[model samples]
Target chain A: MNIKAVVGRNVRRYRELKGISQEELAFDADLHRTYVSGVERGVRNPTVLIVGKLANALGVAPCKLLEYKETS
Target chain B: MNIKAVVGRNVRRYRELKGISQEELAFDADLHRTYVSGVERGVRNPTVLIVGKLANALGVAPCKLLEYKETS
Candidate 1:
């Protein structure tokens, strides 16, 4: 899979695991809801800082968002 | 401590472990030597794609670049 997809997948997985909506995650990350949506959809190529923000909001390490886990 | 610093340190560590100079890494990653230098110095906020490129050049996972290891 592409790098963007890996990030998007991890973001979605973590957010769902945390039981939070995109709006809540966006608010916590101090980002726009649409922007978070774009990130989760793998259409946004977020900077490392943005990734940091999302990781902070999700209470995970920044590297976690970049991890490519096998979903089976 | 900072995210940028974490990335920079990891990049430098990985690059050095591979016994490659900034110029060689730049050539393999298709980035400028100055930019790679800036990244190693924690002065550049690279995009995730750039991190991916660096990781590719270093033969590591992208998450490895973002990892925050304890430097004791």
Candidate 2:
């Protein structure tokens, strides 16, 4: 799989695991809701800082988002 | 202490450990050497794809870049 796909998959997986909506996650991460949706769909290429924010909001290590590389 | 610094430090650390020059790593990752240097200096907020490419070139998981969060 592509890097974007891996990230999107993992983001979706983790986000769902946390039982939070995209909008809620966005609010927590201080990002736009559309941006979050774009990331989830593999259409956005977020910066490291953005990833860090999302991870902080999700209460996981930032590396968790990149963990998809191992499975795919 | 910031996300960019953490990534830059880890990238430089791993690159040094691998005994490769930034030019060589950039070539391996198919990115510009200056871009790699910028990333190493915490001046570049690279996208996930760039991080993945760099990690691939460094022969480590992309999460290695993010592992800095735990140590810092």
Question: Best by lDDT, which number?
Answer: 1
Interface RMSD of each: 0.6, 0.8
Assign candidate 2 its CAPRI class: high
lDDT of candidate 1 over B6-64, digit per residue (tens): 99999999999999999999999999999999999999999889999999999999999
Model 1 deviation from native, Cα RMSD in Å: 1.0
lDDT of 2 by residue, B3-69 (tens): 8888898899999989999999999999999999999999999999999999999999888887865
Calculate each model's fnat, 2 decimals.
Answer: 0.92, 0.92
Top DockQ: which candidate number? 1
* lDDT of every model, 2 decimals: 0.94, 0.89
Query: Which pairs of residues collide in candidate 1?
Result: none
Give the TM-score of chain A, superposed on the true chain A, for all candidates in the order listed: 0.95, 0.91
Flag regions of model 1 displaced more than 4 Å: none
Interface RMSD of 1: 0.6
- For model 1, how does the per-residue alpha-carbon lDDT over A1-72 read when each residue is reduced to its tens digit? 878888998999999999999999999999999999999999999988999999999999999999987762
